[model samples]
Target: MSRIGKKPVELPKGVSASISGQTIEVKGPKGTRSFTAGDDVTITLEGTTVKVTPRGLSKRARQQWGMTRSMVSNLVVGVTEGFKKDLEIQGVGYRAAMAGNVLKLSLGYSHEVNFEVPKGVTVSSPKQTEIVVEGIDQQLVGQVAANIREWKRPEPYKGKGIRYKDEYIFRKEGKKK
Candidate 1:
């Protein structure tokens, strides 16, 4: 009954998958990643394809069916192409730079904010106002970008701050004088 679970994940050329009990490991050009599904769902690898099915008609089983399938799909994509997040800084003198493993940010604060990059993820600053986060894990990449953005969130009035490349800021009208 899960639409997404009904579609098996197809592994592209140069990609392979292995299953051990409730865990499935996907190896691709980029890297290898694994996921462990709940007992409510069963995981199986057929040829180069991965499939997920529910164990019973229970609600938890149905919920895990689609979620497990999506997790498997993410693992495949993560190991193959990886994930990337882009952020840009706004406002005068606001900028970002990379100093070895640390990301230096100048967002109108009194002092520069030094963000130490975590393991398994890479952060780059191609331009003074541009920041790029990359990694094989989608969750890690997104979390790193969010943590950076949290330093100086975009304001509704002027929209001046660090934000995702494609993120939109809803503007509000200024107070009448």
Candidate 2:
């Protein structure tokens, strides 16, 4: 059995949950979000809690049970408290800005990189070196952050690039005589 699957998800007060077919919808004071249940996973609502179970007795089904449960739980929490991702521009001249729905990035490249921000998600860089991505959908927020970081990943040598605020880049000494 899946230990995480056995843990029941407690619905916060004022938050509502509904499961329809393969989709689970969660609405709270903060916002509303929905995600599809895994193919081998089944969800049952019991009072204020939702129980996640597998549809079969196989190993794959067992593996999906806990993951589906955790994904649903995260969706609920995300819609309630929202999700946030912080990125830092490390290079001296590297920076990011927002214009309309586009993210303008200057990563010491010859040309600026223009990224279109998706709907339902917000991106802001209060400080020239720090970028913040926020949204009610946890997966999308994280994906956007990853995409932004990919534009200019931090180098191990000088540690000069875009990276997560809490991320660590192990640096190596340069060649010396």
The 10-residue segment of model 2 with minimum total lDDT is 30-39
Q: What's model 1's TM-score?
A: 0.98
Clashes of each: 0, 0
Per-residue CA lDDT of model 1 for 55-128, tens digit only, reads: 99999999999999999999989988999999999999999999999999999989999999999898999999
Structure candidate 2, residue pairs in collision: none
Model 1 residue 114 CA deviation in Å = 0.5
lDDT of model number 1: 0.94
Worst 10-residue lDDT window, candidate 1: 42-51
Candidate 2 lDDT by residue in tens digits, 1-177? 899998989998988999899898988988888878778988888889988989989999999899998998998888788999999998889888888889999998899999999988999989889899999888899999999999999999999999999999998999999
- Strongest candidate by lDDT: 1
Which portions of model 2 miss their true places by more than 4 Å?
none
lDDT of 2: 0.90
